[model samples]
Target: MTLSKAFYLLSPRNFALKSKIPLRSFARGYANSEVLRKTPLYDFHVENGAKMVPFAGYSMPLTYGNVGQVASHHHVRTKAGLFDVSHMVQSNFRGKTATEFLEWLTPSSLSSLKPYSSTLSVLLNEDGGIIDDTIITKHAVDAFYVVTNAGCRDGDLAWIKQKLHEWNSGQGKEGPVEHEVLEDWGLVALQGPEAASYLQSLTSFDLRQLTFGTSAFVPIEGGFNVHIARGGYTGEDGFEISIKPLQTVEVTELLTKVPVQLTGLGARDSLRLEAGMCLYGNDLDETTTPVEAGLSWVIGKERKELGGFIGAETVLKQLKEGPKRRRVGLVVEGAPARQGAKIVEPTTKEELGVITSGIPSPTTGKNIAMGYIKNGHHKKGTQVAVEVRKQLRPATLTPLPFVKANYYRG
Candidate 1:
C-alpha cells in the first residue's frame, strides 16, 4: 500500500472500540517501524527515562518515568511544560518571488503579512483536499520560514520542490524562489500559563515584545541564538524555540528546570485535542479540505475572490456554499466516544458521521471529542448520539476549543 493508504488504514477510522487500547498506542502504531528516525534530543530523552515510542517515523518520548500522562497534562494547564518537537520539518523559502510562490501554493495572502508574523495554512491537492497543515512565517518580503508536521515531512518536501521548479521557470517576472530545508535544527515548545515568565528569565530580549504568532531570532542564556516563535499548538501562552541541533540538549535542560514539567507525546495529544487543534493522521487527511475542517480562515479574502491557488474551484465553492459536513466539537454524556465511534440520530438511528478524536479530558475531567458532522447537525447545542462500543451515548454539539485559549497577543 502507498504510505497515505497505510496511514489511513492505521488511523482511528478503522479502530475497534472494544479494544479499549490507549489512543497513544494507536497513534504510535501509524509510524513505520522498519525505518525509524531519531530527533537530536533522542539521547536526552533516553537519559530522562522517557518511554520512547514510534511516532511520525521517529522514536519519540511518550512520557517520562514516574510521570503519568494526566499529571503532565495538568501541569501544562496549570504551570508549564516543555516538549521536544525537533522532528518537525523546518524550511526557508527565499528570493524575490517567495511571497508570490507561497501564495500560489497555499491560500494565505503573504504579501500583506508583516515581517515576523506567521499564519497557519494548508497545502491542498487538486481536489482541495488537505495535503498537510503548516505554519508559514513571513520573515521578509523575499524570505519565509515554514514548519510542517513531522509525519508529512517527506510528502511536503517533495510537493514543495516540484511546485518550486514549476513556479521558478513559469511565466513570472520575479526572481525564482529558493528552497532551503533546515534539517539541522531542533525545536522545543515551552507551553502553559507560566511559559512566558519562565522563558523571559532566560532571555534579555523582551519576551513581551514577541506577541502571539510572531517570531524573532534572539540570544538566550548560554549565548545560544535561536528563532523564538511566540505561539504553540497547545492553545496556551507558549513559545516554540528553534535551535541548532548541537544545542538542543542544553536548551531543553535549561527550560525544563523546576516549575516547567517535561512533557511527552501522550500529554501533547490530549493538550492539542482539548485545545481544538487537528492531528494530521487522525483528524486530517488527503480527503479533508480546509473548509470542511473548519480552517477556511487560512484562505485570504483576496484569494477567495480571485481564486489562483490549486483546488481554488472546490474550496471557493465550499466557501460560497457551505461544506456538506463540518468539523465540530462534542461533549459525550457517557463513556468517551473515541475515534471511529459512529454518530447517529437518536430515534431514526441515521448515521451522521464518526468521531475523529476523543478522550476523557484530563484538564476538564469530562468526555470531550471532535468530529465532522453533517452540516445541519453541526450547530452548537445540537443533540446527537455516539455509538460507543455497543451502546449509544448522548452527546451535544459544542463550540470548538473545549477550553478557552490563552494566547499572548500582546
Candidate 2:
C-alpha cells in the first residue's frame, strides 16, 4: 500500500473507533531497528505509559496509555497538552554578521526583527524550492536560535556548515560566524487554551510579557533556567520550552501534572492538521516552493525588492506572476483524501493536482485536506473532486486553519 493509504488507515480516527488494531503494531511496522535514535526523555515517556514509535529517525511516543488520539487531541484543544518535541534539531548561530548571514539563506527580514522575537521562515534552495520550514528566533543583532525539522537534520546541518565555511572565508565582510548544534536538548511544547495559566503557576516570570512569536529565558519554580518560546504547532495558545539535557526529565515531570496531559505524535498530527499546519515529509518537500505552499508571507517585503536570498529570482518572479499551482485547503465530502490522492476538475475530470495531507477533523466533524491545485481552481468555495478509494468525492476549496487560531498576541 502507498504511504498515504497506510497513514490514513492508521490515523487516529481508525484506531479508537473503527478498528481493533493496536497502535503499537502500526508503529512497529514503521520502525527501522538498525539506526533508531532516542531522545533524552525516552525513559520518561515509557515511565508515563507512552506507546513508543519510530519517527524521523528517532524512537518517539505515539500515544500515552489507553487514551485515544481523538481524546488527546480534544484535551489539547480544550485544556492543555505537553508534547516531547526534543527530536527536533535546535542550533545557535552567533557572530558579528549573524543577521546578514541568515538573511542570505532565508527570505525573512531578520534585520528588522526585534530581539527575542521569532518568525516562521523557510530555508530555500537555489531553485527556490523549500529546503525546510523553520522557526528562527533572533536573540540579538549577532546571535540567533534556530529550530529545524528532525527529519532534515543531516541535510540542513551539512548545508549550513558548507555555507558557514564560504561565508566566513570571504563573503561576509563584518565577521565570521560560529554554529553550535544543541545536541540532545529537551524541547517540550505546552499547548492549548490553559497553557499560559498552567505554565505561569510553575514560572515566576510573567508569561503575559512573552507574547506569541517571542521568546525569553524564564526561571522555573524548581530552579531551572530555560528558554521558553510563546508559540507552537497547534493553533491554540502555547509555549515551546527548551530545557538543559540534565534537567529535561525533571522539567517534563513537573509540566505533565493535572490538566497538563502527555500528548504524542498521533494527537500532534491531528492537531496540526486542524490548525492547517504542514508536516515536513507529507505536506511539504524540497520539490515545493514557499509561495506554492501558501507561505508567501514568510518572504520579507524588503527582501523581495532587493532579491538576495537563495532562489530569489524564482520566488520574486512567482510573487509577481503567481505560481502555476497553489496549495489549498479542502473539505472533502465523503472519505478523507490521503496524500497522493488525485485532485481533478469536478465536471470534466481534468487532472489538477494531488492531496498532500488530510485527516478526519475531530473538531470540525469534516474530512479536511490540504493539497496543490491549479491556481485558478484554488479560490475559496471553488467546487472540486478528490479521488478517494477509486471514487470521486465532492469537495470544496476552503480557507486554512479550519479552526480559528487562539494566539496570545499581546
Candidate 3:
C-alpha cells in the first residue's frame, strides 16, 4: 500500500449525500431554535427511562436515573449490560478493488486481513494529524465494513465522496465500487464478564468459539440475525450487535430479558475512561495522530514501509523518529482532574499537557486521567502535576487502565 497505490484505491466509495442538514444545533435547545438528530432507538430510550442529552448533534441518553453511574459501571464489570449505540455510522464497501480502495483512507493493511477480522485504524489528515479514528473489518478481499464516529459524519462522508468521484473518473482506473450506508440501523453492545454466557443462551451457535476482535452473523429469537462483533469500548468480554432499525426495540427487549441490565452513556463514558479509551471530540480531533496518541500500533508495518494512506509521509517520519509528545496514563492525587485539567511538571510548574479524559474509578477508588505530555515525561512512574481549580495537584504517570482488563480471549 504505497502512496500512489493508496490514492488509487480511495477512488470508489458511496456516501449519503441527500440526508437533511441542520441549520441550527440542539446545544442550545429552544422551541424552533434547533432540534438534534435522533437515533432509531430514540423513542425506545424514552420508554426505558433514559436521561437524554444533546451530544454530537444527536439526542442521546446520558444516564438512567434508576441505575446510578457507579452501579451501572460495576454491573457491566461483573455482568452483561445493554447499550443502544444506534448513533454510530455504519457503511459497507464492495467491489473488485474494495480492499485496495480502503487502504487509501486508513493506514491498516486491509488486503492482508482475514475474513471477519477487524482492526482499529486511523483516518489521518495530510499533515499526519487524525481526522478520525475508525474500525475497519474485512468480510472479503472484495469487501469491507467500516464504522466511524458520528461526530465526523459530515466531514468523513464528504471526503469519501469527493475521493470517489475522483477515483471513478481518474485515468486508467477500474471504475466505481459498490458502497452502501446502513442508515437508520441499530447497534447494541452487550459487555462484561458474563457477556458470553448471556449471549450463548440465545443461540445454538457456541459463542465460546468466537475469539476477541472478530465478528459473525448470529441468530437470536424472533428470527433476527445480527452481525455480532466480538469487541467493545469497555475492556471486557463483549459483543457489539448490529441490527436493523425496525427491530431495535424488540431486539433490545429480548437481549435485556436475561441478566443483562440496561446501561446508559454515563456508565459507558466512565467505563471507557477506565479502559483509557479516547472519546472523539474530547481526546482526539483533526490535530491528533496515531503516533502522538500511542496508537502507532494501529498502523500496519507494511503501511509504514510502503508509505500508503494520507499523511504517510509525516506519520512515517514520526514513526521512524518518535513523536515529541505522547499520550499516556496518569494516576493523580486529590480530586479527579476532568477534561482540560492542565498537567505540569511538579518542581518547575511548567505546563506539560492537559487531561483529555478522567474518572474517579469505582473499581479502583482512585483518580485516573489520560492525556498527552511531552515525550520525556511520559515514562511510567514519572511524577507530574495537574492544575485542578487553579491549584497544583501532585500526580504520577502510571500505567493505563488503573483497573486491569478482564477480556475473555477465547
Every model: Cα RMSD to truth: 4.8, 4.2, 10.3
lDDT, candidates in the order shown: 0.87, 0.88, 0.79
TM-score for each candidate, following the candidate numbering:
0.93, 0.93, 0.90
Write out the backbone clash pairs for model 2. none
Alpha-carbon lDDT of model 3:
0.79
Model 3 C-alpha lDDT per residue in residues 156-232, reported as the tens digit of each score: 88888876666666621774676788999999899998888888888878787678888898898789988988989
Give the alpha carbon lDDT tens digit for every residue of 1-410 in model 2: 99999866545445533422223323332444457789999999899888766677777887788887889999999999999999899999999999999999999999999999999999999999998999999999999999998888888999999889889988886799999999978999999999899999998888999999999999998899999999999999999999998999999989988899999888888888889998877778788999899999998999888889989999999999999999999999988878789999989999999998788988999999999998888899999999998999999999998999999998
Model 2, stretches more than 4 Å misplaced?
A: 1-33
